[model samples]
Target: MTRRDMILAAFVATLWGVNFVVIDWGMSGIPPLLFVAIRFVLVAALVVVVPRPAASWRTIVGVGLFMSLGQFGLLYTSMALGLQPGLAALLLQAQAVFTVVIAAGVLRERPTTAQLVGVVIATAGLGIVAAGRGGDAPVLAVCLALAAALSWAVGNVISRRAGTVSGRGPLGALSLTVWSALVVPVPALALAVVVDGPEAIATGLAAFGWRPLLSTLYTAVLCTVVGYAIFNGLLARNRSAAVVPWVLLAPVVAMISAALLLGQIPTPAEAIGGVILVVGVLVTSVRRRGRSEFSLRVSRSASRSRVSAPVAETARAAD
Candidate 1:
């Protein structure tokens, strides 16, 4: 990757990391679900100008359902219920583990030994967090953040499957992000109505002021539109191995920012578990890259040396 892309990746990670603080500040006096509706309303409006992705509507809507609606709805609600910004950022990355497990079951993509080990390690970290949450981080709030991670993982699979519906990995990822957003607003608003009621909704709308407006603009424009655009572009230009690790910086940024700005610091258990969780994600991602590289080498050898199909299959099995 070029220096420019590296800078851009860090920039995106910073924005995403700081987003928890932004959300906490912005949602004051507003219903969490309603905030989701309002934010997605701006995001969905981009469909008027941006072209639709190459994926089918079902794929798009499925991505929207889990990625946008389910993930953010639970996330915002969890924060409102008092999960700290840094911890929420850390816990949400459980999606990395969830994504691997779900893909193994639903897509029949068996994980490598390294990945399985990583999953166990990450789960151990989660157990630690659960046991040590204490009073500051409510159990229900932690569960909701975890549920958000699970939802995000499901969405990740759906988006990945869409890329392969025609047997490809590369995709019109930014377009899909924009188009799928069309599925978020109405459902979020309806959920807000159900959860918060008409009076709260009315009050939330009335409470919409500078902070919320700034939050909407930053999230919709910088985080969703520009951030995804740069990220997808980087993936298109670079190896997934090179691109993915930069994401590790996000939780670090979140934790540091929360500590400095919000006066929120992780408890010892939370810190230890967060570190383990990050290590697990790093191991999984690195092994995945190794697998891809090995596959590439095998494919090249088979093409050059006329490797027999059975020999190739046996080698793959051994791998």
Candidate 2:
């Protein structure tokens, strides 16, 4: 990747990492479901200005269902139910594991040995977090977060499959993100009516303030629109392996931002578990032999060939 691309990747990661804090603040006054609906509505409106990609309606809706609605719905509810922002950020990375497993089953993409081992380690970290759960982090919230991750993983597969079927690279990530987002507002509003009640929705909307509005705009414009645009552009130009690893920095950024902004310091046990979880992710996702390693191997092989040439010629002359 070029230095510019690397900077863009880092910027996206930062935006995404700080997103949890924004969500927490945004949902503070508004009902979670209602807030989500409004956010997606804005996203759909702003981004749908772009011409639609050649993707099918099914593909757009499927990505929207799981990625936008399911993931955000569960995640928002999880936070409202008492999941801390920092921990929520960390736990959401479980999507990586879920994606690998789902791809193995649904897409027939087998997990590498490194990925399997990373899952084991990550599972161990989750076990630690589960054992240590107590006052602040409720079991239900954790479960909901895990469900969100699962939803996200399912969306990943849907998007990948849709891309395959369309014979295009997932109809451009930005297009999928925007078009799929069109699927969110109706169901989310309906769900808000059912769960939060029509009165609560009306009240929340009436009482919406600048903080939540600004939060919504940041998430919709910066996090969703700009972030995904850069990410998709990178994916188009580069390998998935290269682009995907940069996302690992997101949780770190989230944790720090949560600590400074929200005063959400993880418990000692949670911290230890989080470190283990991150390590497991790195182990699972990072390539064993990257470009530098390949270059080194090539150089070594050339050197060996050069050294042996003279010896081989001497032996032939002697014979």
Candidate 3:
């Protein structure tokens, strides 16, 4: 990936990391499913003025289903079920591993060895984070978070493929983000009704406070609109392998923010694991300088081979 896009990805990760804190802070009394539906309703509202992306509705629907609805729906539910915010952030990163593996099998986009190793190392760091910050999270909650990760990976592939189609430029990333959201609100609301029950939804609406509204605004504008817009563009421009690893930075940001802002200090093991995650991302994102140099050498050798046979023969005789 180019340095510019790499920086963009890191910035997005930072915003998202901070977003976890915001979501945790605000979602006090709201039912999780209703909250998910509310946020996406805000997002889907963008379709009124925003230009539609140059993609089929099928692609748009797929992205919306997996990326927006499926991922966040599962994620918010997991937290509602008692997963810690910090652990939830780390668990969601399983998408990076799932993304690379799935892209390799389905999209034929093989990850480099460095990427595979980096993903493994980062995953190990997540395990350490879990150990360092032990909690009695429910098993079902953990499973839901992992399922959210898988949903996010599927969404990444869909968006990547959509971008590769002709006419779907980086500009279309914003469009896709907005347009795909159209498919989210209804299904998400329906799920909310089914899961949260009608009375809970009414109570949540009745007690809806400024905090949730602010959280919705932050998520709708920064995390979803700005963050995913740039993320989708980066994935379009670079390989999935190159793009996904930077997400490892997010947990580091999340833990640090939690410590500073929320007074939830990390154990030494957690700090060490955060450092390891950063190292893994760096390894995965190393420039392909060696491959470029090797190509140059091959070209030089080919040039020498293209020299006239008689001239080479005479030169050899002289030597």
Residue 210 alpha-carbon offset, candidate 2, angstroms? 0.7
Q: Looking at model 1, which ten-residue stretch has the lowest summed lDDT?
A: 162-171
What is the C-alpha local distance difference test score of each model?
0.75, 0.73, 0.83
Clashing pairs in 1: none
lDDT for residue 260 in candidate 1, whole number 0-100: 84
User: What's the CA RMSD of model 3 in angstroms?
Assistant: 7.5
**Candidate 3 stretches greater than 4 Å from native:** 166-169, 290-319
User: Model 3: which residue pairs collide?
Assistant: none
**How does residue 21 of candidate 2 score in lDDT?**
91
Instruction: Give the Å error, residue 52, model 3.
Output: 1.3
lDDT of 1 at 151: 97
Cα lDDT of model 3 by residue, 225-319, tens digit: 88888999888777788899899898889888888888867778778888888888988987643343334555556468896656544433211
Model 2 backbone overlap count = 0
- Candidate 3 lDDT: 0.83
Ranking by TM-score: 3, 1, 2
C-alpha displacement of 252 in model 3, angstroms?
1.0
Taking all chains together, the TM-score of candidate 3 against the true structure is 0.89
lDDT of 1 by residue, 1-319 (tens): 5567678877887888888888888889999999998888888897887778877999889988998899999999999998888888877877766777777678665666666766667667766765676767888898999999889888766765665332122236678778888899999999999999999999999999999999888888787777765665555444333444455456667877888888887778767876776676556444243444456678678869999888776554333
